[model samples]
Target: MARPDKVAAVDEIAEKFRGSSASVVTEYRGLTMSQLTTLRRSLGEGASYRIAKNTLVKRAAENAGLDGLEELLVGPTAITFITGEPVDAAKALRDFAKANQALVIKGGFMDGRTLTVAEVNQLADLESREVLLSKLAGAMKGTMAKAAGLFAAPASQVARLAQALADKRAEEGGAAPAGADADATDATEAPASADASEAPASAES
Candidate 1:
């Protein structure tokens, strides 16, 4: 290709690398065109599979301030630029590679960190974003429920105690202390009667 075309291609690749959340480099050595198309389709809208010249990709990587991909740039390199969820894209590449053994996972990069082939496989093993978020939501809901029960426990115990006291009072017939009050009045009257009798006896003496 001409110099200007090469420069443009490099610029385009660099921009893609810069925009992507992560990228996976693969060697599509014996894959057919139809198979490649199928791989691209399987990747869905989250990722794109493109075949580019190693020299151009290397220059692009450098331009994008990404390093350590130089080793992976060797061979028939096809890069998967993941702009969306990395787990989904990783899963796609992994599943595709499983079906088509011709597609070999070489290495990848995310957040300025390089990943080995094994690490890429590990990434694919993770659950999707939606699944993880759902799990988190379920856990948070359970925690809130437990907290509500905890906060209401003291109030519930107090109510139970009050009810128990009321029940005991009702079982004992709930009567007033009329007998005790009458006895107290009688005791006061007896003291006054004794005082009156003493006064009469003194007057007679």
Candidate 2:
């Protein structure tokens, strides 16, 4: 890559890293182009899968102030930067890998920590964001007594996700919240941040 191109690529990737909630690095050596497309679509609207050079990715990660991921940037590396609920993306990656062994689930970053391959799979095993939110709302809907106890629980992520969904529903029903992120306009059920506005990128590995 030329100097300017490399710099531009690094900047773009750094922006992605900064904006994403989580990232999963993978090796897609033997997969066909058709398979790659299927994988990307399966990741849902909230994920951006891009094939990137390891050197550029390392520079980008460093630029974004994200560490503990360089070690996984070996081989034909492609990263799925997730902007929405990670469990759904993880599950998609996991299920796709099961059907196609060529796509390796190397490791990933989530919630400020590096995850092992097993840990990524474990994340896939968890209930997806929609499922969790639906179940929680069902159990607590109209039960004002449980609302306080629900918020008091240690599961801040779940609480925030559910609250965001609720707020979004209210907005769609012509009752906008006091303050909602303008960037969170995800047509899908998943929550999208400002970063999710970036279209998924394609690169030659």
- Write down the lDDT of every candidate, Cα atoms only: 0.94, 0.89
Candidate 2 on 65-137: residue-level lDDT in tens? 8879988999999999999989999999999999999999999988778899999999999998789899998
Which prediction has the highest lDDT against the true structure?
A: 1
Which residues of candidate 1, in runs, are more than 4 Å off?
161-205
List the pairs of residues colliding in candidate 1: none
lDDT of 1 by residue, 45-144 (tens): 9899989999999999999999899999888999999999999999999999999999999999999988899999999999999999999999999999
Worst 10 residues of 1 by lDDT: 171-180
Q: List candidate 2 segments past 4 Å from native.
A: 142-205
lDDT of 2: 0.89
Best by TM-score: 1
